[model samples]
Target: MPRENSFSDSEGRSLTPDPEDEIHYEEPAAEAASPTYSIRTPWSPTGHTVPHPFSASRRSLHSRAPHPIPGWQNLTPKEKFRITVRRVMAMHRGASILTTGGRVGAEPGVDPRRASADALYSHISQDCVIEVVDYSAVRSSFGRMTNKEFVNFMGDKSASQREPWVKVRWINIGGMSWDVIKAVSIKYNLHPLALEDVFHGHKQNRSKADYYSRHLFLRILCHELGDPDYSPSGHSAAQGSTLTGEPRSMSPEPMRDEDRLNGVKGGDVDEEKTMYGTPPTSRQSTTKRRRNPLLPTNRRDVDGMPKASNSASNLARLLKREGDVKDARKERQVEEVSIEALKQGERVNVKVSPMFLFLFRDGTVISIHPEPDLDFTVPITQRLRSRDTVLRTSADPSLLVHALLDLIVDRSLQVIDEYHTKINKFERRILLKPKMRTVRELHILSGDLILHKRTLEPIKTLIYGLRRYDVDRCAALIDMSDPANANTKVVGFMSHKSKIYLADVFDHMEYILTSLDMFTSISENLIDYTFNLASYEMNEVMRRLTLATIIFLPLTLLTGYFGMNFEAMWSVQNNSDWLFWKIAIPLMIFIIPVFMYSDLTRVFHFIQKKMVTKQAVKQYKRA
Candidate 1:
């Protein structure tokens, strides 16, 4: 018989090692292990080993080595910089310094200690700095650092003082709240509006600058906080309390009108009388139980004492008052609960991701990443895989601080594009219906039509800024152009490609504007038509009513004349029954003959004249 054990092997089989086998398993001595070393290949072939001619000579040997991860080849210059910065920063373990701001410094004589260090440093090196600033002392020291002082601190002191590129990563965490914005603003001299936007977490695709400065206002569309899989209950409780007047923890008291009206009848009156010796004075009893003014005569007094009802009317009134009290209590409770719920629900945390924006810099602005970089990546491939790729360029603090006003213009373009896409789709669907009721239908269509109109002008302004930037860059590149150089060909091709893309965007925008105009005109016309039709309908109704009144006027007049006393006419001396018929018959005969002869003669003469006129007109015209 073998003893049972709780332990199991890797395969889930119960392990019962023999005592003899267990004793054989000994720990190896650490000193017995061999040291590891990297092997170095010999430059020349060893005499002991025969070298085959098929294999290249050791000294001259060559084999394809896996290519160094294709650096900056498949990536844009910006992307390459991003990747390089990230890789460089990840290598550092200790605290690091980052300078962020413009590419230039303030003029000389400006306090050296009061200038933006990053800007000054960039001026010296002609390189953009994306380093991490020391944040440990940020909270305490930030307030003391002025804009100029900060710049000076970051200014280049010497070649030795130059810092390598430090990667600044864009984090898409639960968006920057007010606290984050304030902290960032203190550290970076950000505009209040820019900070507010970040704190509020309203992200757009572009960035903007504040008036008269390079301080950027960036919109970063970020996801709202909380679970996406939420469902609202369809039944909203009406804003009122429960039907019970009692507190939630307490049971409702049963309403008893009869009990209240009995006035403590059939209960220990003799005991109460004995305690008082003589019947307690009415004044004492009334003092102990004061009646509610609003209650009926038969209602209970304030100490829960019953009151006597003199008549059935009093009892009925008491019951009605009790019912009213109950209803009031219920309504109050409902209202209180509803108010509490609304207060709790007022501030909802919405989850958002980056979209488009209007970014601002100084007077100049250009579209930064006009189209979303759907293929942007982060260091952690797995995290990147789960996240959206198009980060609002506004999320880049560097861009926000450096970019100019035209940021909003770029975002406006994006807004226009979105608005146009939606409008076009809507228009196409509406146009499918022929003979639409123009006004009502057009009004309904206009709901989504002018949605982004307000955003358009601002966007156009930004576009202008971008155009200026583009022109400047183009001019600079042309100045650097060497017609005979192969590189010029590459640059030219890139310029051409950029123009093509710009043209495409412009063409699409033009189409949208044209479509909007056409739809607007059509809608206006439809509205006019609708009003006209309504007016026409009203006129027709009025005309018909007038004609009806005219047709009935004679009949109404005849009825009125007949209704009056015509006894004098009827009682004419020696008037016979035949006399009435004689007068009416002759009048009818005369009227009918005259009407018939007039109609027949007019018709015959008109036909004869029409024939004569046709013949004479034709002859005269021919002659």
Candidate 2:
């Protein structure tokens, strides 16, 4: 090979010569077998020579090297928008198509006020329905109210037609509606960002709690019933009319919302208050409570004993009370309902869903049930209907929040129980007869557990945050300004009592997480065990095949030798009748194995011992 001379510019900088600038001719060696030409011309139809379009010496300009092109800047706005929509649709094939509106996918810290109400409403109306419940605690008058009525009562300080005072009010909404949610947001002065979370219930499926200046927003995830055959005895047929167009199953005296709305009678509303338990009718005084002023203040009557009042009148009253109690006791029959009914409902196999609960500082709870038809808080409703329940007696809205949290945790435990049962069944199957289907089911169950973990961890963190604030002490509050809460602020009117109760929920969530972790490990181990079992079975099959091959190998050879056509064997060639005896002799070769069975066993034992002795000698030498 010969080196080519380099070309340079006047500045002495090296420059590569262009193909067009270079003059080239084929060498003698290149021309021997194949000739090289810079251009090849062809004869035209008229016998005229035509110039070649491409020269053989020139390199192709179409290189594989990448070149930059102006893309987005060159596209029109409409074209860009169309392309974006197409890409989004392609990516979301089988996913819910959400309208781009109202901070739907906005980055953190984006101003929610910049979001349009119409956009939010449009997004929510697709799968949401609104329902509200309002009750006056002091007057003990309860009614199902609409959005307008709820807003009116909550917004107005002078609207006391049903009750002179309202200690606690609850507004329960079923399903999600952007417009209705916005209305409630405005009326209650809810945090804008928190309000944004209200519309993202099922899709996000995240459990979290955010506290604002006026309310605490809690998202709880719940799985449906656990047991397939579980049923509660004497299950209440109807939940009292907490909403209109629903069946009313009150105790005859409770006020209906229709009566209050129609202005039927003020007296009816007053009667509704008495239904909640008002000083026991004619037997009790209107101005008196359960405690009597004449009784000794330091002592209370117990076990049918009179109070130490040192008065004959007090003694007689106590005795009369005891007699009445004895008569009531004699007629009373013990009604037993399983605790399981209080915890697990009839529908245990339903899918898991999220619930949005808003607890206000003013003792108003606004809950959004994603499943409009099924109310998971039926137990709470049952408690609320009875006069002696703490929910009715205390008139604390936070108690309702606690009850709901308890319900959510209990439901999670039930779901865990179901998983535990499934895990046990899978373990048994794996031990007895491992299969691919069982392993697949375990893998799927693990995924569900991970989903539940995602939901519970956030809830656990929120509850811990509330616990740190010590909501009950009121001396300290969660500093919303903390850098940690940058994504969502917790500066609002919070029920300290509710925060205290949420601690228990935090503990329950931790336990559930631990259970999930265990179940996940079990699933992973089961998969590994399945593979191990398969490998073991394969080895067992190979061992059996190898043993059979060793035992029958000699027999196979003997039969092949006897079946040969070599007529040189003396006895067989001399006598044709002896062929049967010859064949029998070859067949009798199998008798050797039967004769050596005991001897082969001894030989195997002797060999194994010798190998062990050799291994021990090697170890001894190394030592």
Candidate 3:
């Protein structure tokens, strides 16, 4: 209660509050640091409103501002939504995220953009089969195993201890599931980059051969064509078609080597007679006889499998002899297959797949198939089971690899032959009747050829790499010592025999590549040829219409002039004599000469010549 200007607390201070004593409120640190959004719409008390992170105001701010994601910065709203979805998927269990132009040292927790250039994989599906073939010179075992069994067998030291003489192991993995791939990756210490390449499911993936510290990784695409018209049980369709400049001749009798050796050029046997003096049956009787269950099963070996004699005691001897003969025959045929002229005109539909192989210097091969349907490994498996086959004799898993590649190459050639047949048919159809539909089909055919060429080119490169492995440049990768002698064994090399055979396989691939190039060129030319033919036909149609118009134009004018009822239009309206002489004679004279004019006379022939010449040039270029 002191005076306002003179009051003080104990020491004569003022009783009124000082300016420094008043409180000054402060803004929160989090609120000040956080981003602010300008409210786009005013709130209403009646309407319920909940805070949304993706509110219009926040979205507007984000759209107007730069984002941190490198690739997401310029993306549209729709693209951003899609990217967000992809990000969510990447965040799921067992799925890895991939970034644009990623580096070569990416890790799990690091930023994807800063990570290495490896393919992203997800461990979702586990439908796969693992088969192991453990073999040596004397004994072999084959079985289909589970992932657990595979891991145990691969990791167990006691496996080798039990079978001390086991020289080679071949593991065939069908259907590339992430779990199986991951386990194998860990077991073999496979390079992460190589694993990335293996997991990538793209048609454009190149055929690559990478020599790692402990293994050689190879990836090859396999393609096959399907034809519904060709019956597998019927006569060889390939023998009837001659697209590859090969001829076909069908005779009532098939000539045998024994007949040729006996100096018999034409077959001595008649189609109607049997060797044991049995009368030939009529068509109906033959059909009925085939249906009769009493008839013994006269099965010939289509696959060159071992033949069993009816006698049980002699079954072993007969099979052994037959196997030896089959093995010898197959070996001889393998030598002749490359040189044999293949009759063309095969109609095939292509089924494309991929095969990935990892070959270790110790004669271990791990084959991974992305496509479960294509089993070219079956033949190799059969040979592995045969005692007299070269696969068993050599005891090399690399042989199996080569054999599989050969099968694929051979299959590709067959598909190409089918394409060749289709090309010929298309040419004939277009020549006989040209249409826009035909042109579209031709373009599609050309596209298919291009696709095949792209696929095969990579395989060609892989073969070339394999062929070069034995050269001076790749000698460091070869190991010539026994695997048990670790002191002399080299890690990243192939066996000498494997190298030699791979060169042969390389030759086959080169042939296929050359043929593919030819087909691609021909297909392109065919497309152009079809389009040109259509244009030429169109021009011919236009020319015919022009000719018809020229012929009828004068007559039309004369009729119109006479038909008009106006008084001054024509003086011959009522005078029949004048109309007949003046209009009719003059019209005939004009029309006759127009039909004989020099311009019209040579037009059709001139166009025909031009088109023919252009076609000739195109054909020459295609050749």
Candidate number of the best TM-score: 3
Q: List, residue by residue over 1-623, the lDDT tens digit for candidate 2.
A: 11122222234322221234222212233211111011223323334432221111111134333222125455457644644453333222201111111112233221122212221132232233343434444335445554334433433435523243666666666655433455466456566556545543343356776655567778776665623543322123242212111111210111223432233244332211221133322211111010001122122322224444333344455457546855765554222244333334212253455678888766678887755443676787667767677667777777787778778888878878888888888899999988887776777666667766776667677667666753432323445477775565333344566666777887888988899899989988999999998999899999678667656666676566666788587645776756655655665566656756786899999999999999999999999
Higher-ranked by TM-score: 1 or 3: 3
Q: What are the runs in model 1 whose C-alpha is more than 4 Å off?
A: 1-174, 179-451, 469-500, 517-521, 570-623
TM-score of 3: 0.54
Task: Give the per-residue lDDT digits (tens) of candidate 1, residues 310-428.
Answer: 33334344456667867997898689667545433212222223332222222112111111222211222222123242112122322321222222224334434444454454455
Candidate 3 error regions (>4 Å): 1-122, 160-162, 226-349, 372-374, 469-492, 564-575, 582-596, 600-623
How far off is residue 305 in model 2, in Å? 97
Give the residue spans of candidate 2 off by over 4 A.
1-115, 119-123, 126-139, 146-164, 226-350, 392-394, 430-435, 469-500, 570-623
Order of models, best TM-score first: 3, 2, 1
lDDT of 3 by residue, 14-99 (tens): 22223233122123333221111011221222242222111111111124332344334454576456445533322221111111
- Give candidate 2's total backbone clashes: 8
The candidate scoring highest on lDDT is: 3
In angstroms, the error of model 2 at 205 is 3.8
